[model samples]
Target: MDNKAIATDVLAAVGGKENVTYVTHCVTRLRFNLKDSGLADRDVIEKIPGVIGVQEAGGQYQVIIGTNVGQVYDEVCRVGGFAHETAVMPDKDSVGKKSILSSMLGTIIGCIMPLIPILIGTGLGKCILMIIQLAGIASSDTSMAFYVFSFVFDAGFTFLPVFTAIAAAKHFGSNQLMAALMGCALLHPNWTSLVSAADPKFIGDMFGIPLYGMSYASSLIPAILIVWVMSKLEGFLNAKLPELVRGMLTPLITLLIMTPLSFLLLAPAMGYLAVALGDALLTIYNAGGGVVIALICFVYPWMVVTGTHSTLAIAGMQLMAQTGYDPFSRTLPLVANMSQGAAALACALRTKNKKFRSTCLSTAFTVFFAGVSEPVIYGVTLRLKRPMWAVMIGSAAGGLVAGIFALKAYTWMTPSVINVAMWIGGDGLNNLFVAIAAMVVSAIVSFIATLLIGFEDPTSDEVEEGADYQL
Candidate 1:
């Protein structure tokens, strides 16, 4: 879709490359840390071709660009001569202006957003493995073929701490190598063995104090927190340490001090905090029943809109570890995502402009298959205004049905048509059917509602003035 042209327009609209401090993207949005947000034209940027929506949240300027965000991001970087390899942290001045909560949210989003592509690929690989097993093509989990694929796909999650550490290190402006080494220490075979062993002696005592040994595989909080502290320590040391000794000694001192603090203090404390939060969410889910589930589904798209949905990954991971499945992941695709796709499809059918129709169709395809809804939500529904109500209505209806049926996902995969097979073994074939039913209900409802409510057609002038229409 002329990605280079779109990138040029985006760069210009945001007040040229000089106005940008940093630029990065998630599944569907180009997140920009602007030097002066006031200088950029949000409305004009929103109207740009290929741009779906623009939001100022968490001290960042976000431009929604659908699934092609990565391609567009690459072009944006190329046009602006920005480095994609380096992490893009918010400016210190920007952080100072934001509340603690906003700053924390921004930090979490920045650290985790970079990992989405790899996570999606691995999740899909795991789904493929499940499909093979379910089809009886590979009957045994112990088969050599299974083992090979399993390790290849599972390694990402198994060593997730390392990736998180790298991202966190970049976000916090720390030594990446040292941060990665600390992550490795958390998942070291020797330490993991000690924790998994039957005898308490394997963990042994440290200065008459029993060591708390917990496997850090697939963990999020500890890796992020540890690296943050490491970054601060390294920054302090870099300023104080002699220039001649800084290179080698800084990493050495940081690792020596941070490692013990991580294992003996930070990891255990963060681990407990994760568990407590997960337990609390589960408790609320149990107590509130179908009403809570419906509400979550209705508000899920809004969460994605504000970048708060990424936080759920932590709770979803912890819940999977504890309960062998996570209902949150399952419910989202059936209701929130399906409804968004449906609304996009409605826009495509109802719109007369050929270009807008094509864009809506492509967005619908991404939402239905990839399970990313931000583009559809921001680009089409939210922009059109009335269609958003249609999506919510459809989502609430579908969520009610899913909650009533008690549909849950067995594996930790993003909810999508590709991962529908994951529902097969955990909740029986009936649950899978119910999930399908939920999707159908959401899509039909949203589509019909959008058609009924209708939206303003893009005028020739508007289309020419700005590429505001979804592409």
Candidate 2:
């Protein structure tokens, strides 16, 4: 019933080392791409000691493991092998494009995933800074002590392009280092100073090509394009070149053809696309902000269920950076996360089974305090149909309220209760408080709703021993 035994069972169920095509873990699940989907014994895997559940969505067989998922994933990879073992699966063509709906959801979750650890770490770091400064234990200007906490907290966002490139590359099937290098090129020192100056001439020429003065630091688009291009180039070279020459030839060709193109054409075009997309989102906001929020609220839970929320996070950040506020789309998901968390907590308390009880408790606490909702999505709401209604009711109420306030968020901050401060100082504080209040009200209201409308009995397997259910 321990993690090791559970991991062993999972390895065996998913066709063992040979069957695994590729493997990775998000906040809550061990997502795998298998050579033969039929090889996986979902029921058997679901009944494993540590696993919370098993489901196939997004073209991947996902093993739910609650909070310590990363640890289990690591073990799976170790016993499995990079290609023959846990890490062996290559990126398959089937993992290609999903519907626009799926893509949008995927982007939102992707955007938030990298940002979560950084946001929580930084927010708490800032909290520490506040405590120390308030208590005369530290000073922003004079204390070397301030720098330590400040750097740890602030470094992630500051170097977000690098972080984004890593995640995006994994998503898009490119060399992570090459993608990171491309991100580095986008964030090159010279580019930063040029963009900051806002000089028309800053958009200079690169070997007869016009340089696009876009900042890549915390920005999106350019790095994604660069990485996408990298994937194509890698694939092209791998396919055409002979195996003997591929070792040296692929990287050379990819870097030569792809890198220059990334700097000259890809980055700039994507920058333009990003700007256009942000503008488009704002246009929608200006026209029907209320309706947009209501819809997002309604479907956001489904997005969460399907691992598609990352798109929104990226789009929201891009929108916020381009225009002061991102129409009505920015804060709806925040409410959704809070609502789901609250509902899950209620379910945790309502359920008699130990597995549901543990999952609900851990997921609810983290989602409430830290604003990470994967636990609730994987462990509770998705399992019990009624709890989802609680999330929906809360999301609809919260989204409508958000739309009415027309709240504006300036920074690309995470949707945590702690992030309320970052949203306060920028632009005017018009509906910032209202947005926060709506999120809180929605959470509480939805939590109570779940209690009133209870769910079916937990499955016998869902009530297993030593589940270690924390999200």
Candidate 3:
């Protein structure tokens, strides 16, 4: 279906555009903050042609649309005439009533969801480069091809603050350009040079406060915190200043005040918190070992349902910065995705309904190859009820093996079969073998379980017409 038609169906399912307070999308879902959640037809939305499923969680109505969500989101914005920045902001009354935890999760999702496309693209580029380097196709790391490819792949993570700050500003109702400049300040050549210096004294002082130099490259928490504060400061300044000078003066004053504060307080504080959280998670993984990993895999689908899976990305990034690799974050998720896909494929093989079978096959391919699992999970597994257990069981089996082998990813990438190449250089052949083993094991186990467990085939009404469905 065309984007406009999809948008129209989506808007109508969600009780029309008037009911929408805001709309945004992550990698595979369109998240909507509705004025009245009751007005939305959840069952109807789930059955929409392009929609994978519907989720009401984290105080938002989420429509799962697989990987094409970005295109649909753009169309939704156009059709609804809702500004992207304002679309995500909650109603004023609802804001004060939200719990601290909900507010924090919402902010994190807002800031990070916008960056997923770039993150995935750069991550895959890095993976491809690694494979080429490993194959001796690009022998010299010093070669121009190597440098160019490396920079192209590495720049996204290396300069994450710039992207994150802009997103956070939009989320927090701040000046985007000013927020972007604040991010640039964190990565400024002068600041970076001081931080790179061997001696502590080289960092000097900023406005009577000591500058404890630290690199903000690939850092998430610091950029988010800095921008949140900047938003508040900008709002205050804009309101208090005269209309004529406000545009110019608000940003200038906000930057001057925030830059010093960031260097002196925000960066250090958030950096420590991020480290502590990452360390705590690492400690838990080390202590619990395979059992913990298995449990994570078992419950992962539920996390995705609750819209809390994005939290893992934040933690994983921090862990990667602190340590050279992230073992806990991406490993089990990869297995779970493959398992979900496997279950869907099994359903495809067993189902008599040609249309439903076709959808199952397509979604299976999308999940297994592209690592987008929502379609298979929501459209098939959860819809069938029996396959979800099979997926979890298979995922747990794979997670156990992964944890026992201590499989790790050297870089931040979306966990998928395509990302298996990333395991090559850092951890040697054993880790690569383990990753492959995890995929194979999960797929086989889930396939077998789904076939044995069985599910009721969809009725005639449930089947839709479309051979070209791409999940």
| C-alpha local distance difference test of each model | 0.78, 0.70, 0.81
Candidate 3 at residue 436, lDDT?
90
Clashing residue pairs found in predicted model 1: 47-467, 47-468, 48-467, 49-467
TM-score of 2: 0.78
Candidate 3 per-residue lDDT, tens place, 1-471, comes to: 677888889999898988877778988889887777788998788667887677766666888887888899999999998887653455665565556876677678768888887887887888888777777788345579888878887888888889989988877777788888888988999878877874633377677766776777888889999999987787788779999998789878887898789988898788778878989999998998888998899888778766777788778878877786888888867888989899988999999988888789888888878888787777788878999989989999899988888888877777787778767656457888988998899889999999999999987576643222445
Model 1: lDDT equals 0.78
Q: What lDDT score is found at residue 371 in candidate 1? A: 82
Runs in model 2 deviating more than 4 A are 36-38, 57-59, 83-116, 123-154, 166-178, 195-212, 231-255, 320-330, 344-363, 372-380, 408-424, 427-432, 451-471
The worst-scoring run of ten residues by lDDT in candidate 2 lies at 82-91
Rate residue 178 of model 3 by lDDT.
82
Question: Model 1, 1-471: lDDT tens per residue?
Answer: 889998999999998998877788887888887767888898788767778778777767888787788999999999999876665555666556656886677677778778776776776777778778867788345589787878887887778889989988877777788889988999999888878884532365666766676777888788999999988898899999999999989988887898778888898788778778878988887787677878887887777777667677657777765566777656865688889999989988888887777667876877788887876666578767888889888888888888877777766666777668766656347878978888888889989998998899776565454344444
* Superposition error at 69 for model 2 (Å): 0.7
Prediction 1 TM-score vs. true? 0.90
- The number of clashing residue pairs in each candidate reads 4, 23, 1
Candidate 3: give its CA RMSD in angstroms. 2.5
Residues 37-126, model 2: lDDT tens digits: 788998788767677677666556778776677777667766775521112325455354346654444433443354556645665566
Off by over 4 Å in 1: 15-21, 88-92, 140-142, 198-210, 347-359, 452-470
Q: Report lDDT (Cα) of residue 319, candidate 1.
A: 78
Ranking by lDDT: 3, 1, 2
**Cα deviation in Å at residue 155, candidate 3?**
1.1
